[model samples]
Target: MQVAPRRTGEWWISPAIPAVANAALASLWAFTAFGGWGEQAFCGVDSAHDPTCATGFENAVLSSLAVVIPAVVIMVSALVLRRVRHYPDRLGMMLTAAAFLWVGAEGIVFLGGYLAQPS
Candidate 1:
């Protein structure tokens, strides 16, 4: 028998917290990737090898994975808890997991591309 949720309409809270956390992490990653703290900026979205940007593309990509990976792990864990373990307030879990997974996979791809580029 499945237990009813404790709160009447608070299922949003679980996903909201993770979404906000991911947003914050994304912001930080963007800042670092764009040279927010005196570091050279990475190439822009429209130009992957812009002459003005920094040459350390791999480093920027790696750092972004540092942010994306953890958020993905957390969201995946929450999804597993809600689906397999039958945790409560699971309303937004799937969406949250999907968003995180998409972002994380993109980060991995970006990292791979930079890593494979000629030095």
Candidate 2:
């Protein structure tokens, strides 16, 4: 889960980590779509006639709001849970691991995208 700072000014749940994860996932998800998936459906959201912000996964920067919102929810919820009793420590670690996996896969795709081009 999430752990809030204990009397510290710093936020225990880092936004950067999740932001990076979001970027990676969004990029991978978008690039995979290529010409077909873009402007279609994403995150179970129906995007019809909307391109700029129509649930399209074209760019992570553009999709940051969509990704960050959920991540922040989870982080905040986890932090609240951390304040309460009976919270498992592995939860946060598992999510973090999943994020890493997502980043790794996206990194591979990103590399392929660049290397596949003729420079």
Candidate 3:
């Protein structure tokens, strides 16, 4: 029985969606970018030397939540916001903001790579 906030009457989105989206974007970029589950993950790492599951792991993308964790967080947060916006608990909103900021910061930091669009 929770009601969503009305739009600004100019835009089509709630504005919060973008932050959550950015969180997902950042997470995808971080978790699966560069060499996350790179060639090493699929085919192999070296032809001359076989990967031992410990040597080149250092080169893999480092996310505390592995791969799917961040995505789950973003999705769950979105659902929670849609359902609990009317609740008095501010923790959900705070988490959404924090996730957005984390992603935005990562985007800014790696702007030279992922941020660059193919022109």
13-108: candidate 3 lDDT, tens digit per residue: 344554556567665655544434432343244563334332333333343234335545654665576555444344345445556555654444
Per-model tally of clashing residue pairs: 0, 2, 0
**Between which residue pairs do clashes occur in model 3?**
none
lDDT of 2 at 31: 56
Q: Local distance difference test, per candidate?
A: 0.52, 0.46, 0.45
Candidates ranked by lDDT: 1, 2, 3
TM-score (C-alpha, index-matched) for candidate 3: 0.33
Model 3: how far is 28 from its true place, Å?
Answer: 1.9
lDDT of model number 3: 0.45
Off by over 4 Å in 3: 1-13, 19-63, 66-74, 81-83, 86-95, 98-119
For candidate 2, the TM-score is 0.37
- Candidate 1 global CA lDDT score: 0.52
lDDT of 3 at 25: 64
Write the residue-wise lDDT of candidate 2 on 1-119 in tens digits: 36587566854554445545655775665555454443333322353334444322345334333444455455445445654213344444534654655555445444433333323
Model 1 lDDT, residue 7, Cα: 79
